[model samples]
Target: MANFKLTISDKKGKSQSKELKDKEANVLVGMHVGNEVDATIVGLAGKLKITGGSDKSGIPMRGDVYGSARKKVLLSKGIGLKNAEKGQRRRRLIRGSTISEEIYQINCAYDGELKIEEAPKEEEKKA
Candidate 1:
């Protein structure tokens, strides 16, 4: 069983922290630090991009494409490969191992606007 800690902050300096169990943590399997994800906190939904985090082994974790080995080659190619193919290649290069026992400390920022709507009040009955 793995646990992940998430620290989420909004543009207005408001922040929230929470923890996720194994099942919930799996949703972030492919996502790395600095990656943006849609999240809901206390009924307020928005987008959040991870800022910093660490693995179970205490190793700092970062986004897949942040400091990749193949980044240079991929970016150097002068549009040789199709967009889809390029994307596939990039995924393969940055994907993490499945067997790693890493619990990430994700710091994310809310990117989307949180909108709350109030129901209109009904008029009082006339005498």
Candidate 2:
């Protein structure tokens, strides 16, 4: 039973977030970065491409890395490192590219039209 928080982005730079659990969350397991998934799985109508994700501990996944294990890779300027001087490199802990049950958040890029309908606001009657 895995739970996941999905952050979906469209070509227009718009993004939406959704939470999935149990069976819905299980659909994302074993997927890797750059892989494509159906948006319908998350109640959307489009195709979603897997970009990246982070584990329960907030360790980000790197595309260069393989499998679903955490590793300490030497990074100069990347997702893990925020502010680094020129020619500066440091070993940072990052997760692999694969998605697993331990993953907490998954980032995706959506392809196709996305239209989200909002609930209508009610008007109060004047006394």
RMSD of each: 13.0, 2.7
The number of clashing residue pairs in model 2 is 0
Q: After superposition, how far is residue 86 of candidate 2 from its true place, in Å?
A: 2.2
Model 2 per-residue lDDT at 59 = 96
Question: Cα deviation of 7 in candidate 2 (Å)?
Answer: 0.6
Score residue 116 of candidate 2 by CA lDDT.
61
Off by over 4 Å in 2: 117-127
Candidate 1: worst 10 consecutive residues by lDDT? 91-100
Q: Which whole-number lDDT from 0 to 100 does residue 106 have in model 2?
A: 96
Model 1 clashes, total count: 1
Against the reference, the lDDT scores of all candidates come to: 0.53, 0.89
lDDT (10s digit) by residue, model 1, range 48-94: 77666555544444343444122223332223223554435432222
Per-residue lDDT of candidate 2, residues 1-127 (tens digit): 9999999888888788899999988888998999998899888887999999899889999998899999999999978888999999999999999999989999999997556666455653332
Error of 1 at 18 (Å): 0.6
